[model samples]
Target: MTCFAERAPAVVACAMALLLTACGSDGPAVVEPPQETTCNGVATSVRMLAPFESVVLSGSSAACFALAGGDREYLVIPQLTGELLPYGGYGFRLGDPSPAVVARAADTTSASIPSLSAEQIFGDQVHSLDAQARLDALMRRREQREATGVHHGAEQPTLSVIGVPPEPDTMRTFSVLNTLGETPGYSPVTAKLRYAGARVLVYMDTLATSALSTSEISAMGAVYDASLVPAVMTAFGDGSDIDANGRVIFLLTPTVNALVTASACATSGFVRGFFYSHDLSSTAATSNRG
Candidate 1:
């Protein structure tokens, strides 16, 4: 699985104005050469750890692909692997029970399984030991702010103008070709996405919001039917299970940089976005599970 977001010009400018700098495989084995017809500019074939299932490449550029046959659709960047990540590549699943394994195609039929894990997207960086210690201190400070009522909750606002459904002229149609040679038998897949637009919620109080971890802020708004719910509550499209599973998609765009150090910001790539696998895995009160 991969999560990728475009690098905004403003964000790139911010990084340039501020100046910032910023997993994977095992065993050699038989590898199938990728087809000349590339999927999303990746000449190399990519494989997922899950069984050969359904897939759909979104948009004409084929920048994103969604893995099917699961409860939630796994939108991924086919170009990236655990180890090698470009500016716009990363992978994680919201409700997937198993760890994600997306890697360059190899004949692993006989060879030991190629190691795989999530990659970072643009602006997404992991905290180092020192950074974590700094974050711990920051969290304590945030707690004090909360005690002083500086962190009072409010309604989350959606970016109504953003993610609007595509019109006929604006909508681009394409077929999803099988990139992974493992599923040669699978037929070509095509789809038309009717975007009713996503519920793009923006946390209003940046000062208070930035103080808390993304998970904490998410709990404040992303949880289903909870107080201060972020998403516009509604049954998606006639209330039917599109994937025949009792689950809905949830994504969190956190400002992880606010909690990290300048060195981390300078070294680690910008973290544009990420999924909440750890938050979902928890059965504790903080878990996003509903």
Candidate 2:
């Protein structure tokens, strides 16, 4: 009885302490405040792209061109950014895809035809064929050209092309792969139509394009979703899912290209050349894989 009496107050005090800890405070649980996302020096123009996030792709001034599809676009941001330091492509005027034309001056020799990877010519970030695997594709192409006396044929060898740069004596016209692998016809004689630049050419296959006016804007959108988007994804993977959503969103805009329709700019006061609108609320069957 003496021992029990001695320990009773101590046990009661311990029980009281446990009860207080379990009860916590009379107010409520504390929560850390949500973090705020801010773009410090982001221009109002770039900031207004969307509420999610954005980045400025910088390197060279915007190279402008008119697409065979009647949509003129420019190279504002590089496709691969830094991985491929000089990321530029041949800008063929709007028609059928063809082999590169090395119109060297009579004084220049065949040895002057500089060789380059297929990716460099076709904009690997948008092309289907992998360049690294086919190192001698250019040689095979030359052989095929010699045998058939044809620059382009049904079996289009895509792996590499002659890296013909702009020279005072060499007026070379390189072919570029459009959305559907068709050429956009003869490329214009531009001073910047060389092997080195900081822009990626974006254009559609001439064969696939119709007389696209503002009325048939939905057709253009369909082409973009079906052909253009998949090509880009194939070229540059799906990219990081920055929004944490299962789908990836790619926002492509030309710093100089004009919007397709007035209706598109109704909501945002401006329109991007191409953008993905994944159905976040839908299932795999209905939702697009951005």
lDDT of 1 by residue, 61-131 (tens): 12322122112222232322222222222232222111222221111111221212222211123232133
Per-model TM values vs. the true structure: 0.25, 0.18
User: Cα RMSDs of all predictions?
Assistant: 20.4, 30.8
* Candidate no. 2 TM-score: 0.18
Model 1 alpha-carbon miss at residue 185, Å: 46
TM-score of 1: 0.25
Question: Per-residue error at 264 for model 2, in Å?
Answer: 23
Cα displacement (angstroms), candidate 2, residue 224, comes to 2.1
For 1-290, candidate 2 gives per-residue lDDT tens digits of 00011100011100000100010123443342112211122211111111112233222211111111111111112122222222223121222111211000011111222233456443433332222212123323433444565344343222223233223222322232111222212122111211121112223222323434323544544554555545445334564332333332222223212321345233223321222222222122323222
